[model samples]
Target: MRPFLIALWLLIMPQVVQATTDVYPFESASEQERFRELISELRCPKCQNQNIADSDAPIAKDMRDEVYRMMQDGATDQQVTDALVSRFGEFVLYKPDFNQRTALLWATPLLAVLGGLLVVVGLVIRARQQGGAEPPLSEEERRRAEQLLRDRDGGV
Candidate 1:
């Protein structure tokens, strides 16, 4: 029983240490909400695809702390975003600003869809022009076909 208690204490000690978080007291409920929103919007530079609010990376922790600090200092949402973007590049934003550089990136899917639509339309038009029925066999070709069939059927 003594050894079991010691082992249980060892197992729980690390969990207690891990459970500690950097708790920032907000000036108001709205301030706390703003903090949550900003962190959720800002991507974690280290995690690439995860928001700072949900990321476990050290960079995310740093970003969260920076956001809290900035908000406490009265930085607006855009200012906080701009600060992170300046430091980490536009990749830190989940939604980057549209610019000449990103114009092609945004336009690619539309272009592809239009191209596909055009191909389908052209195919439909071509199919309509061709029609479902083969052109009426020429009279000469029809006579030759009958002659060949009769010959193969022993002139019947």
Candidate 2:
């Protein structure tokens, strides 16, 4: 079973890896480098966690084509990124611009961590306060407990 699975994986891996290499012929090395950088920096909407350079989704392919078209038409990196952002919203960017609209998205994790710390601190203070003193027993309850202990010790 292990051998069969390994063989199956070997057969399938090439096609998966080959899918991302849709090369567009660039006029210069710098243009090709820019293209690579742009694709790697742009997020694939369909794949969500993957950049277009690493994603094999149909939308990623379309985005790569659009980028190539824009680059061929002499668009700057910022211009191409801005164009895609306008079309797909800021979600298409791997590093989204720090803006008013995205402030919550950027701040949520830190806020959650701080809130968690506050909760932990509150719990620690409560535990410390409670531990500082033993709970008081009522007078009748204390007499009953003493009587029980006396009986248990055979009145010794």
Candidate topping TM-score: 2
* Consecutive 10-residue window with the lowest summed lDDT within model 2: 14-23
TM-score of candidate 2 relative to the true fold: 0.72
lDDT of 1 by residue, 87-108 (tens): 9998888878899978887899
- lDDT tens digits by residue: candidate 2, 25-134: 98999999999999999999888589998888889899999999999998999999999999988988877878899999899999999999999999999999899788
Q: What is the lDDT, from 0 to 100, of the residue 69 in candidate 1?
A: 90
Runs off by more than 4 Å, candidate 2: 1-20, 136-156
Candidate 1 TM-score, C-alpha based:
0.71
Clashing pairs in 1: none
TM-score, each model?
0.71, 0.72
Which residue pairs in candidate 2 have backbone atoms (N, alpha carbon, C) closer than 3 angstroms, thus clashing? Answer: none
Candidate 1 accuracy as lDDT: 0.90
